[model samples]
Target chain A: MHELSVAQGIVSAALSHIKGTGKVREVHVAIGELTLINAEQLAFAFEIASHGTPLEGAILETRVIEARLRCIRCGREGKSFTCEECGSAMEVLAGEELLLEKLKLVEGDGDAQGI
Target chain B: MHKVSEIEVQEDLLAANRELAQQNRKLLDESGVTAIEVSGAIGSGKTTLIELAAKELKDYRIAAIAGDVVASLDAGRFEKLGIPTVPLNTGKECHLDAHLVSHAIEKLPLNKLDIIFIENVGNLICPADFELGAHARVVVVSVTEGDDTIAKHPAVFRKAQLAVINKVDIASYVNANPGRMEEDARKINPFLEVIQVSAKTGHNLQRWFNFIVKAVEDRKQHGI
Candidate 1:
């Protein structure tokens, strides 16, 4: 599934950001509602994707953001494109995103000292 | 003692694919090609729609990108119709990504094409998440697929601007309710244009043809 690919993506991202910092403790990710990614499934996918790598046993922390829509006519914010007041078409402003927010790392045998 | 530090990454996980999709759009725009991504369930008649378009539309030089998990059967069908087509095999992947499409586009005679119909591998879920950089996105669902299909697979339906309900001529035989299906789709996507047609019988297929024609015209006039 695509989740496996996405999971590997985050691991790579975390490692890149954590260069000489430490071994990864947790991978924090923020997903939008429109992406349709199931966090549980992604976590399961991360388990397999991170296997035997430096990120093994690293935590997968995902936060799903709700989609925000605005009416094209009245500029009303709502859940979908259809406006409740004037019944006009809505445009999505946010909530269809896949972002790797940050990586929580524990000190490793690197030059970086604990904060 | 364990020392922890939260390193800010702020990387867009889908940026790589999105970048490729943008590149594809740029290529299409430069080549003056309008692409329409046709996605649906396996038996939803996507290949048939392209074949019909190839037969009916006389004004444009059309090409196709047939995406299948394994064989080139759909591409072969398009080739038989004298449609310049590239067969894209995704192997283990469920849907066609922008990278594959970009390569497929390079393999075609872009200068000879007015439009390209990219027939995505038949599956609703994966394609919804990946942007293939087409000018328009349409999801084909049939009455035989059940009226509840729109409600069940709202993700793909939501992503599409058009919803086509195919095989309406046999609606009665299959106990299918096209009306309910349309309503279901409209409920999920208020702006989705729903068209009911039987590709086999050529019933109201002119509307689908017109949709493609209008898309190509709009792209040409407005410039994608």
Candidate 2:
């Protein structure tokens, strides 16, 4: 799936942020519902892409955010695709995000036990 | 003792691709090549539309990059038309990213080309997520695919600058309503320019050609 590319992107971003720091322990990413990325597939892809890199054995955590749409006709905001009051088309206001939110790094001793 | 620290970093997942896309945009602009990304489902007549456009826009030098999962069948068609064609086998990739396109540009005779059309892998969902630094994005939907195809794939339509409803000649036989397809596309993207054409019978193909010529002219004038 395209999640492989997405996972590679996440690994790249995380590695860039944690450059010169200690080994990465966990990576937290936020994907919007509109992106249509499967969380399980992303984790698998991340594991594969991170192999032999500093991110090896790092835990991948994903958080899916709900889509938000704004009604064009009624000026109402909600998660639904259509306006509940006016029954008109709604514009997507959010939920297209695919961001590397945060990273957990272990400093000092590089003990791989209980990772 | 090992200490775990949480660092808050908000970075886009597609940042790397987007950065390369910017570079591509600059390259296309500097080379004065009007690039357009054409995306659609399999057998939706994407190659046919490009073929027709190449014939109609004979005054301009045209080159095309065809992307497919396995075969370069579409690229062969372009070669037959005498247009310089580059076929990219994406292997496991669903769509062609900017990185691949950047490499494709290096192989082409950019100095002689006026326009470069990128026919994305036959799919709607994945191609919409990628930006290949094209001046415009066109999505083709044929009548044989059903009128609801536009409504079914809103994400692609939303990003596309133009929507081509092809195969109007077979609309009656296939029971596909072209009007509904245009209306659905408008619902998704109100500003999206739409045209109905039949690449087979050359019906309304002139309009499509005119659109391309105008886009190229506008890009040249605005330097976009």
Each model's TM-score, in the order given?
0.93, 0.87
**Residue A26 lDDT, candidate 2, scale 0-100:** 89
Best by lDDT: 2
lDDT of 2 by residue, B104-179 (tens): 9888998899999999999988887778898999999999998899999888887888999999999999999999
Candidate 2 is scored at a TM of: 0.87
lDDT score, candidate 1, position A16: 72
Minimum summed lDDT over a 10-residue window in model 2 chain B is located at B10-19
DockQ of each: 0.54, 0.51
Clashing pairs in 2: none
Model 1 CA deviation exceeding 4 Å by range: A109-115
lDDT of candidate 2?
A: 0.88
Q: For model 2, how does the per-residue alpha-carbon lDDT over A36-86 read when each residue is reduced to its tens digit?
A: 588999999999999988999999998987899898988899875557777
Candidate 1 lDDT tens digits, B1-224 = 66777888777877778889999988998899999999999999999998888888888999999999998999999999998889999887788988899999999898888999999999988898888899999999988888788888988887787899999999999898999999888877788999999998989999999999998888889885
